[model samples]
Target: MKPSSFLSLARFGLKTILFRKTDPILGTIIVTDRCNLKCRHCSVNNITSVLYPYAQIRDEMHKLYDMGVRILFFCGGETFLWRDGDRNLRDLVTEAKDMGFLIVNVVTNGTFPIDLPEADLILLSLDGARERHDLVRGPTFDVIMENVQNATADNICFYMAINRLNKDAVREVCILARETKNVRAVSFNFHTPYPDTRELALSKEEKKACCAVIADMMKEGAPVFNLKSAFPYLIENSFPTPCRQCVVMENGRLSVCGRCIDVPGLCAECGYFFVAEYTLLFRGKPKVVFEMLRTYLKYV
Candidate 1:
């Protein structure tokens, strides 16, 4: 991140904390719900399968920016699958920066080539090592790895959603992120089990064990993009839900926190680490705020 961008974000954070503002600082736009692969734990893919038109997407970006969203994420059923005539995902990233978004990130399943060097981070899903990952996301691990190895920039962050099947492979992914050339770091979220995927949800003890491994990896100098200070809140789901500093826009409709916010009773079981980290940060949790500074500066 650029110094100016970092400073601007710092100002926003300080103001939000001091004033106890609920305005959003981060926003996500779902470019499309069209996906090539159907992962086992996903409930949102292929419902509409619509690649939203470029004009509509551009308008959504403007709306988010106007609403004080400086950190932008272009998400997908598969981002690389989104293309409207001549425009592609890369064009959106560049356009977002031109439109003055301080930090623009893209989230993809890593099933396609990664060439968006303009993005600050490409949150690529890698669930686990070969067999485990293949089991969850189908037999595309080799293809995704090849894409990561040949990506145009060193901005890839391994995004792992830990669940029953892939929980044991967390260490394998952390090691991969540490060793992979184009990868910058690994970020984690425990599987937020939707109605259909309830069986994949981890028990409290399982979540505790996963956090222990992640904390140990951080100590060993692995570049993890998540804050260890928020692990307890994440494990217990004790942190505030529907983070006020974050919002999501899908197909022009907006929602606070995430699209999952619409799922009734799901907030209590939220496993998203960022929600725990951010909500705790704005609520003036000293350790979370301090460790967020340390972790983000080091890896983001």
Candidate 2:
């Protein structure tokens, strides 16, 4: 992170700690639910297949900015597929930076060309190694890797969702992140069991084993984005749910945390490591603060 960006995050962290604020400092706006791929673990795609108009997205950005959100993420059902008239995802990213967002990120499956160098972070989904990732996310691993290599920017982060299919390959992903050009780091999240995807959720034992692998990777100096200090919390699922430190906006409706909050039991089963990390940090966990400083300094 740049000095100014780090300072902004520090300011927000201090204010949140001192004032006991529950308001969100980071916000995600789903530009569109229209996706090109139908992964087995995903439940949010292909419902509407409508690209939200540019004007509506702009309005949503302003609304989030008004709500004191400085960090912005543009999510999808594949952000590359999002378009309104002649505007593309890059236009929205530029607009967010102009509107004073400290960090602008885009989360994608990495199936398309990653030419958006304007984005501070391009979170490319890479579930596991070639065969396993292809099994879950379809036969696009080679293409995604090619796109990653072809990408002009160096801000890509490998976002892996560990579940039944890819749990065994977590170490392989760490190696891929280390060897791949333009990939800055790798972040892991357990598969949250939404309504129909319960079978994909890892058991507590499985989650612990995966965390052990990640911990070893961290010790070996792999560019993994997860905090090693919070592994215990993640294994026990003891962290608070429905983290109030972040919010998500889809269409015009805004929900605390991400869209998972609206799902019935998903919040109770949330496996997003960042949610747990942020929740613990807000509650003033000394170890978590140190972990965040170390991981984020390396990431940015």
Q: Which candidate has the top score in lDDT?
A: 1
Summed over model 1, clashes come to: 0
Residue-wise C-alpha lDDT for candidate 1, range 73-130, written one tens digit per residue: 9998999999999999999999999999998999999998889999999999999989
Tens-digit per-residue lDDT, 1-300, candidate 2: 679989989989988888889978899999889898989899999889889999999999999999989889999999999888899999999999999999999999999998999898899999988899999999999999999999999999999999999999999999999999999999999999998899999999999999999989978878998888888888888998878989999999999998878788778788999899999999888999988988788786
lDDT of 1 at 84: 97
The C-alpha local distance difference test score for the whole of candidate 2 amounts to 0.92
How far is each candidate from the true structure, as Cα RMSD in Å? 0.7, 0.8
The residue pairs that clash in candidate 1, if any, are none
Each model's lDDT: 0.93, 0.92
Off by over 4 Å in 1: none
**Candidate 2 RMSD computed on C-alpha atoms after optimal superposition onto the true structure:** 0.8
Candidate 2, which segments miss by more than 4 Å at Cα?
A: none
Error of 1 at 179 (Å): 0.8
